[model samples]
Target: MISVLNLNVQHRGAMSGVLTLGSLDPAFEGAPAVDGPVQLDLRAVDFVEPAGLCGLAALLELLTQRTEHVSLALSGRNVAAYLERMDFFRLFGGRVEVHPDVSSLEERERHNPGTLQELINFHTEEEIPRIINRISEILKGKEYLLRERVAICSTLSEICANAAEHGTSSFGAFAAVQAYNHIVSGSRRAGEEVIISIADGGPGIRETLARNPQYKDHTETDNEAIRHALEMGVSSTGELGRGGGLTLVAQISARSGGSLSIRSGAGRVTVYRDRKNSRNVPPFPGTFVRVSLPRHAAEDRP
Candidate 1:
């Protein structure tokens, strides 16, 4: 019998029917020994964010390793079209069988100005500079202030660099960035926002930090490791001036009145300007980062 794994899109909540990084089920993360066909059912999904898109890509990479026949069941025209715009099918379309044909959506895909950077897969640190230069050029054509552009690009490069350095995997890494006209998923407030996300299939934060004996206490739990990672000068390598990239990225987001969230293993943490919140979540096989940067409207800006 074919095994069916539901994407578990939330039914009711602030993120109802929306797939985010945390929406992924832990079952798939643990049961990678499958020898039979597997179907990822996402028909109930209505929307997806940058985090969700990258997470989904990472999950598919993991599933493809265990089984030959992988089917993706998707519903909703809007969601399908959005995925097409983000080049999801271009990356994985040929890899999986789609229940309902989405070829039409792919054909109709048009340039989305809000898509600062569509989902991209990179294998090494060398690939990141090109990605950064491309996104920087895109930002230049937009109305973003110089500082705003720097913050977004810096946040992206820092996380992408971290993923390339510590989270290297056979599948490499995935990154995406999008600007929304209004606050859609994370918060209830009204304002324009930019969401940047990156995910890599490397060893999780806990295992990476555990590599260094000094982090034994901090690596006791996934949450502890993630929280410890946010601190300046914390990394698997005990070298000076290293491991401060993520710290600087967090500062950039906080200064913009935005937040940065990181997830790996079973821990997820979100950091804001004034405080930080940490929680235990479903196990994510890789390190995932999401940054939210709010864009104040011209009328509201001083």
Candidate 2:
């Protein structure tokens, strides 16, 4: 649990315990107090999103609470972005220290996307297959097994296609396609992370899924609709879903050690946290399902 590390805090091997990246220097107190600055190697780190940033801010406050003087260093592209956000900056109050840039956070964010993100306002039902195929192809050439690759591809296709078919049908196909295409064009905006939010003007998932005769109007059960969808032979698509798709998706996720999230009506949101995030997830009103899994690791697990 105790060892010297660079600024970035790479484990250099498999880790056991949870590593807390508090805003303050975790080791400033116990160290011998070296004269020269400690070069924290943060190159291995990616960005922490708004949610994750909240956790980091909480840790910083905890440090302030527990200790007297904890030196603060803002390095890495991601750490800087969190600091830049108005919402995140509120964690440290109005007067936040604008430190010198250790790495070009802006430049790095330009090319590499972090694990979990939302691609709001870009994708449509008609083009769903194309994106799923593209991601599958990316996974195909990787070091993962062929079966795992196929599983990820299929699960993504089902979740997204269902989201589009059911969620966007009310908006007319052409308009939906145009709206989604716009999202693809502008993947990067100054203050926005690309996220896809698909909302349907039709009946919500609760109203729709419970209509299935097999469900027997059991709306009160915990995660009933979602669980039924994950059951072996439940299909909301009627003829389109010959048997079970979401079940397959859930099984694949469970086998791969990934996560799946579902939000129905207005009061329900279920998030299945995989180790990381993937390119697919249903986000918005109606029935929204988002699957955030790594392209390869999902297959590498079990």
Candidate 3:
């Protein structure tokens, strides 16, 4: 018998739905071995941003590992088309199955102005610089100010470097970036924002930091470990002048009046310019980072 997982897409407007990392919470609970084949039903999903895209990719990777066959059931043409533009099929087409075959969708142009970077997979630190360079080039062509571009690129490079160094899962890491013309979530729905999401399957922050005896107190909980990891010069390696990348990324987001969120194990923490918030959630197999950089109208180049 095939196990079916119904995705819980959040309602954003009257008729549109958004798939977010929190939307996939149900699938992570009561983790069970996938027997036989599996199906991910995304018929309710109307749109997927960078965070959701990366989350979905990570979920698929997890499922495929337990089952030889996994299929996706997509509903509307728009959702399929959006995924196609994001290069979702190109990365997972060979391994995973798709319903309502997207062959026709694939024939369409593969360009989305809002997309700064498409779904990308990387395994080692050696690939971080190239990925950063490509996105930097993309941003250069847009109307983004030099400072905006620097913040975006720095956030990506730092998180990606960390992913490559620590995300040891066989599937490695996945990242995606999207620039929304209008704020998609949160209190405001009118400002432009860029979202970057990266997920990796690894031992997670708590376990990783536990490797260092000096971080024993900080590693007591996933939230503690993540919070401590955000401090400048703190790292599992405990090497001087190391582990500042994430701190820098957090600072960049804060300066932009955006936010940085980290999730691992059973903890989720979000850092803002004024304060930090933490919560306990379903265990994530590895570490996930989502950064939001909002573009103020006054600051954007005309």
Candidate 4:
């Protein structure tokens, strides 16, 4: 019989999902010796954000690299459909079987193969424009000024490129975008918001930055690492004008009334307008960056 492992529902997204993955090491302590399929029980998981979905994909990809067989047992029809929409099944490449056969599996065939919702490997330069164009399309009717859109796209490119260059993971990096309405005090706002998250299953920010000789004397916890990483000139490369990406991103976020949050190692940092906060949490593998942009109101409506 195959051993069944239950995926934690509480830690289903963002940094929590990464932690949940880290907690599964014991389940696969001797995975290569197992001859039968390893069942991943996903019945308890009802919701997952795009970042969380990517994290799970990265985890499964790692497991498959170590073992021969892995299967997914979805808990319910809704969860199955959710996974389908997120294209989670594609990661296994026909290796894993679903408990209940998904009916709309063929619908994926109709989707454009170039769609940006598809996971992007950090190695490709061509994928960056597709991602930026997709985000541009999402904001087309939202009346963002051209300069604002440029800033957002540039920030995205820089962040994703950084992931590709510094992540140092065999699994690479993944990014996804989602747009939704923002509600406050039981009321919906006039503007919509887009959330874009990028993640990589590599060493966390603190570990990566510690390689720089200049930072050797600087003692940094996870939270401090995140903060320092965003400063204008701080970078592991230790070169002049090398570390302005996150700083520029932070400036754009503040100017546009958007928000940015980053989680790496055991710390999480959030910046909203003029305010910034950091906290300690369960340590997560690698780094995750989430950027949220609100619709611009100052632009002329077309």
lDDT leader: 3
Return the TM-score for each candidate structure: 0.90, 0.45, 0.91, 0.76
Stretches > 4 Å off in candidate 4: 1-39, 107-116, 182-190, 254-258, 296-302
Q: Candidate 2's residue-wise lDDT over 44-84, tens digit each?
A: 34444222232233333333444343334445445556444
Which candidate should be chosen as best, given TM-score against the real structure?
Answer: 3
lDDT values, one for every candidate: 0.80, 0.40, 0.81, 0.66
Alpha-carbon RMSD, candidate 4 = 5.2
Instruction: Give stretches of model 3 more than 4 Å off.
Output: 12-16, 112-114, 185-189, 299-302
lDDT of 3 by residue, 189-301 (tens): 45677787899988998998899998888888899999999998888888887788778878887886788899999999999888999999888889999987775665542
Which residue pairs in candidate 3 collide? none
Instruction: Encode model 4's per-residue lDDT on 210-242: one tens digit a residue.
Output: 998777655368888899888888888888867
| Native-referenced Cα lDDT, model 2 | 0.40
For model 2, the superposed segments whose C-alpha errors exceed 4 Å read 1-123, 169-202, 266-284, 292-302
| Residue 2 displacement in candidate 3 (angstroms) | 1.7
User: In terms of TM-score, how similar is model 1 to the real structure?
Assistant: 0.90
lDDT (tens digit, per residue) of candidate 1 on 217-287: 99989989999988998988878967776787788778767888998988989998888999987778789
The model with the greater TM-score, 1 or 4, is: 1
